[model samples]
Target: MKKSVNKTITIRDIALSCQVSPSTVSNILSGKRQVNSAAGKKVLAYAEKIGYQKIHQQRFKKAIHLILFRKHKLILCDTPVFSALVTALDNCCKAQGYALSLSYIDALTLGEKATQKTISQIISDPTTPILLLATEMSEQDFHLFENAKAPIMVIGNLLPKVPFNIIDTDNFEAGRIAVQHLIDKGHTHIGIISSSVPFDSAKKRKQGALYALQEHDFPIKAEDILYLSPFAEETSDNMTQVIQNRKEQFPTAFFAINDYLALGAMHALIQHGFSIPKDISLIGMDNMPFDCLVSPKLSTIEAPIEETARQAVLRLIALTQETEQYIMKSYMGVKLVERDSVLDLNTCK
Candidate 1:
């Protein structure tokens, strides 16, 4: 009788079984390089089935990965809000002895395969925590992160019914406060400047504003709601046409979904001979730095970007330390920042 030999399963064995290169298996397991999602999944499944053990690499310091997922560049840019959030996250991570790394994934241009590949690489190391800046990510885009092994947290957006850690501003409350402020100022007819891109945050804000309008018995008119392009230039052009055509019946006040849109609307109004506060009071969300620089400083609802970042980092760190974890969802409060743009109609008369 010949003695049977038991050999440890290796990367080469898994690669040959899965019909892929050893380097491919190594990259997928080590997360040193990006691998195709399909191939990676297959390789991972096979390795798990065969009980293949991979030698873990030692690292000197812990790391946190921040992935900014944008469906379109027009909506998510290097604006004050983006800069502030990133800086805050970096600071928080450094304070906790974790090195922060950032990655931007454009889903529209990369398509599903490439995006998934990049995401897989980021989540390959289960030891590293991930923070997804999902401001422009759709509900469908979330499916990719569903199977992530890393402790993941989403920022600047809310995902209902999806189990994940999230920290976002109370966009609904922000919208409600903006519109309510306008209403309290004696503005009867109000208009909304919404984006053509259907972002979850924008949708929630619009819904909240609508709720406030309905609560106050204000008539909701389809024509009053203007859907503008995400780009500032395009938004201005679109608003210009709307203002020209509706000059006779334009609303007294407009609640722009964001500060950029508000500035675009302001430009159109100014060019068309309409005065801010005097002719049309305007309010916006996201108290971006530029809001204060513009003539007739914009009144906006502060989005709590820094607070959201801090909370997200804290929760993600907690998740990484836990033996048992639960899906956590948090909404930071938003407040109205008064400025010169919105007129107090009650004081007018």
Candidate 2:
């Protein structure tokens, strides 16, 4: 037998070898459409064996990139709600026949050079769409996406001024519902334990709380509201000092911006010899897992974390496929998850 030299195998050659149409092979390679898993595997394996170089040149070739734009160390992995969103995004990507790549844009310390580098890599390939986990992103942080080529969608509680597609929970409504629950319990005097963090969700929650107070004709006392540091230990210490200092003016009930802050306030109040829902009533938002694990199960507002993630991914896909145009600002609803943490003031007397 005579020796034969290897020739360059084109997509048509691969398609012919796999006994599938060239379009099917191209679709499989580009991740443009879902093909039979066995057929896809066969094509991929054969292409790899023949040393496919075209696919290697592509960036984000057949995947969705999840960029976590955070200003703090507590990125998506640190918080349970964010974790749920990530999980949902992963599942959604898998279902859509796309691989998901995760990257972090630490806007907290993002310099010009680094920002340009990240933007370059993102726009390097127009086929790969970007799904931004921008829940914590500010208006300035969103400017990074101004020159991006790939389709982008944001998942968070608030939308930035830039008109990109966004899917977020209705934090304002969550705040309103939380405070209304306390009001329904006949707590005319209520406090909101908040932090100085510049989170949109936190701000909306505060606005909602104030709205509820105004609706019920309850006096909004500056003395009743307590502001603490964002850090857990600092929050705990500040809450303790505030509670002790304002003991005489303490409100009958307290609503925390989130479960963590709520937990901090609860611990401090208890340390100051005030029992939860006994000497003081408490409620929180975020429906964090700790809410259920605590000594007194915490009542909280459930943020639509997973649903927002799923919707964001779906919207991103739609954008990439050109099935939808015009940026959309979508809001997911929130619900009150009542547990043992709240006290019905009517029953107390």
Candidate 3:
């Protein structure tokens, strides 16, 4: 251990020795950054060895607790798209000198009766802000936020007329963009593969699809729209049947709510002896990493994941700092990425 008569061992000194920025060293010392786990560990060990002073006490209390709704915790953690959003949120928090912690509440395991305890545990620190996320959480469940002492901001679900702050993509607009692309390509026969569950995002996207069809004066047929359970194992076969039943009348293009559903639809289309973009063009939402790796390279609506994450953190900070009285709901824009999966009918002709 380096014995030091000096009590003022600066953050820059530690940063220089560690070959990282002073902000990074500070973030590591204050438990704000964890994305680069190895770097934090190395910095910690080095600091301890050099007898670094405890400077974290002088830092501002910028802790943020991220809680996933019990109903969709597994999906948020396990899925690549949702997991990437969570990671982006984490890194954003760290970059701004805010400590971010993930709080897990298992509603399935503990049952609905234990909700009070869950809320109590989540708001244990009154000063720390809370960021809640869920794929399909209801307003009734969101009422739990009223009891939390910390300022709250929700991600993904934006309840209409609610006072709570929200940061999410314009899913309805994204849906419109996806369908309009097919329409612009001269595809009159368009299909939508939607989730069986009544998720707001999926519902909004479907509505957007309907609006696009109406705007373009295209006939909306009931047989062209298909609903399948996102979690079901038999989706591949069901998707096949949904198209096979239509047979020669099947839509020449499809819009899926997400990449997972798009991949499923792709597999089913291929199984039914259909060539992608040759027989049918497919597009999905959420530009997940796997979208590039798949055959034909998925055409998708790319949500501003990193920007949304940064905005959420900044809004939370503004609210906590009293710079903003009410944090308004914000929607980030999305763009369609044209790829091999979508075909231009004019060119094909």
Candidate 4:
């Protein structure tokens, strides 16, 4: 019986047989450049003669990359949510022994070419895995994932239309519950500080709040809603516009989309000398870093950030292991964390 050797052929073998440099052989095989017809023929003949085959690329490095879609460079400082997210993801990765890397995407950074250079490197490597901690993922971002073999998990509270795996908090439920909490406290007319995510992202959350209101039969007037900037710092002028335009039209109790909105709205209220909880009860989500440090601790919805991070790492590992183990949707539940910011209007009178 003849022995069948199981071995991958080398570019060196083809180069030597064709009397060409290894780099020329590599360029030909990688399809980076076209060789002359005569040279091409020589290489192809050599390949046929030796039954040359490409070596199977090795993987199994067991590291994951977390890519953040930072449309603005100031996402970290502007939205402290990233701080919590990074902390949670880092601790989780450490526990699981997986590596994490971050890259921000912006017009200036990826202007002429949306090729996320850092991400391109990772994708080019066959072994590494990827998770995207993204907000406002664009057409270009989708292009990056077209043929990617690595499992992609997008971390956010909103549901995007992308087909990649998503691990997120239930912002819609968060919205509904935040408003409902105010209603339970006997505030009939509740207002909201809406978020400024992209249209596709923000629609469902706002709809969820309305669904809760209608479900509970709470009358929510449209004028009471306030949306703040997602990309920029809080400005007094914007808050002033909301108050001037919407003061008497809405409820005293407010459900701000996230904690940052609550803080910015609080600053506007303070500037106008409005008493917290005495005149207006406020609720925000995400229990941001400033929540504890502020004068009146914000009554807010607390998402399980640390736990979300821990689970994301595990999910990535599993996806890498079993093809069927891939996860498409994961939502972290949220709870209300009450503080001094909200007042029972019943007690006020």
Candidate 5:
């Protein structure tokens, strides 16, 4: 430690040795200017030999709390995807010497307080960062973020258009590819069942599906896309109607927005007297945990949840290193998983 200070060289030393102002030497350290190519290189080499570190205030605070703000809606987080994402994010946070805390926004049953806590309540400190797993942010939520002055990075499509970085999956491409795969398989009539509403991901996936149909010259009428209640009980009517209305139209293939949607549609298809693959081939997204165990395994799109989580953690960490408003974003890739649910045209009518 004494040697570090003993040999300690200041920018002043370099400026004097190089016959330049201290500011010129400082600029060289910050890499701000090209101070005469040869002369700049000399100052940089001297600085490195002396070992100088730009001491900014102490590193940003420690742990960042990840607040998942959905009080009334509980989605299972036990699957491999969710598990992997959570684990990766946790691991990244730990490795960075940061603590990760998870709190359910709705669990407090904070009601209006829940909303208030989300937007207005942020632990104030310049030391660390806050990683908000707010996959879906509404207009009100935007106002919440707008009012805060914390280091924040959201996990999904941002609502308020705040400059905090966002890390999300490419839902649109996932949807487009799922539909494109079905089209390539020689299925002309394709159907879609959207699991939820106003979910930017859900909407983008639907748009991708439409893009596939449009590209393939297939019909995509308003009735063709079904936006049903995501809850099981509320899905019965809409799923039944979709299966009934499209059966004869030979809507031989369908794309469920997610594994759960496919599962529900599978139930409805069975109740409506249709056999998987034989009567209707299906492809879903998220490749949910049980997709392969069903009567006919489901073919679906895989999401890089762990990678998504890891990226989110990394971006948030990077955000803490600066105060500039920038767009830090990343999208993981998607691939098709072939399973028993798809009917091969060579053997099927």
Candidate 6:
């Protein structure tokens, strides 16, 4: 017996089998030109039956450029969240017949003249679709890309006023859910550990936590909210100082804006001889891998990072294919991941 090689299926072969012109087959397959309904249906059915592979034309394929706009070194770094998002976007692009490219704009060190030049160079290519990773960007920083001619979408941040397609995690809802969980656990007195850097996501999470507290008729104290440095070490130091100053009074539970801050707070609590969930319950957002690896583990809100990236890529591709461009704002939902960090006061009783 001899081994046989499978033959490649082509549009020409499909057209010959269907007894139609190659141009008619090509037009029917691509949907660029209209063909007779009966002929189109027959050609499509035969093509499917024979397993005809439709190759995307090189000229029609577009590149998606992901611009990682880093205004500071705090939020957007070499972390698992960032890595997962990038990987998801790459996978989506490959599946959608588009090439993906990455660029970094570090405004922290880039001078004004150089930054403007870089922005100009990026926006110069009108053919390529752009997806901005604007996690650390401010409204002032977004003005740089406002005038671009390319089809642009923003990821990881929400700019309500700026008209562009956006895909971001629902930070506000995540914060509310975290606080509500603590409240349901009979924690009326709760504290929020927020970033001092004033990222939009952090601000929204803080607002949502505050809103949840207020809705529960809980008294909001000025000292209960603590703003720590974005760096984990600095956050730990600041938390330790806060703990020392308020030795007599501490909230039964604390909600950190992100896992980084939560871990830092956990270290400070442990150092100060406070037991997790026994003396103080805690929760955080952005369910990083370290959440599970920690001693008591961390209860957190899982940001839909992979889903956000996938949706952003799909939407960006859609925008590129559209004749009339329209702005779309999409908010991906977050999930509450229950772990060992939270203690239920209701069960204790």
What are the RMSD figures for all models against the true structure? Answer: 13.7, 11.7, 7.2, 15.4, 16.7, 13.2
Score every model by TM-score: 0.82, 0.79, 0.80, 0.74, 0.74, 0.82
lDDT, candidates in the order shown: 0.82, 0.77, 0.78, 0.67, 0.69, 0.83
After the best TM-score superposition of candidate 4, give how far the Cα of residue 145 lies from its true spot, in angstroms: 0.8
| Residue 262 alpha-carbon offset, candidate 4, angstroms | 0.8
Give the CA lDDT, 0 to 100, for residue 126 in model 4. 61
Worst 10-residue lDDT window for candidate 1 reads: 51-60
Residues 1-349 of candidate 2 have per-residue lDDT tens digits of 9899866455557877998655455556655445568888899888888776444444224688777666765433455665556656766676667766667666558777786686677767787888877767777767768777888887774565777888888889988999999999989999888876667878888999999999988988888777877786677898887866764768888999888889888888888888888878888988887788887899999977767777888889889878557889988999999999888978867
Q: What ranges in model 2 sit over 4 Å off?
A: 1-61, 74-77
> For residues 1-349, could you state the per-residue lDDT of candidate 5 as single tens digits?
3554544344456777887655455445544355578888888777666555332112214776666656326242334455455556656665676655555556335667665754465644455467776655554565566545567777866433556677777788889999988887788889888865456678878888989898878997666677776665657666887666765464788888877778788888888888988888889898777887888989999987767777777777777787666776566678888888988775454
Number of the top lDDT candidate: 6
> Model 6, which residues run further than 4 Å from truth?
1-61
Q: What is the lDDT, from 0 to 100, of the residue 34 in candidate 3? A: 64
Candidate 5: segments with Cα more than 4 A from true spot: 1-61, 71-80, 107-114, 158-160, 232-238, 241-250, 323-325, 346-349
What residue runs in model 3 are displaced by over 4 Å at the alpha carbon? 1-61, 72-75, 232-234, 244-248
**Candidate 1 wrongly placed segments (more than 4 Å):** 1-60
Model 6 score (lDDT)? 0.83
- Give the least accurate 10-residue stretch of model 5, judged by summed lDDT: 52-61
- TM-score, cand. 2 vs. native: 0.79
Q: What is the lDDT of residue 248 in candidate 2?
A: 70
What would you estimate as the lDDT of candidate 3?
A: 0.78
Better candidate by TM-score, 2 or 6? 6
Off by over 4 Å in 4: 1-62, 72-78, 116-120, 138-140, 157-161, 196-202, 245-250, 325-327
lDDT of 1 by residue, 1-349 (tens): 9999976455557767888655456546645446568888898888767655322222217788877787888766766676667667766776677756666677888898898998877778888889888888877778888888888998867878667888888889888999999999999899899998888889989998998999999997999999999887788999888877884588999999999899999999999899998999999998998898988999999977767777889999999889989887888999889999989999989
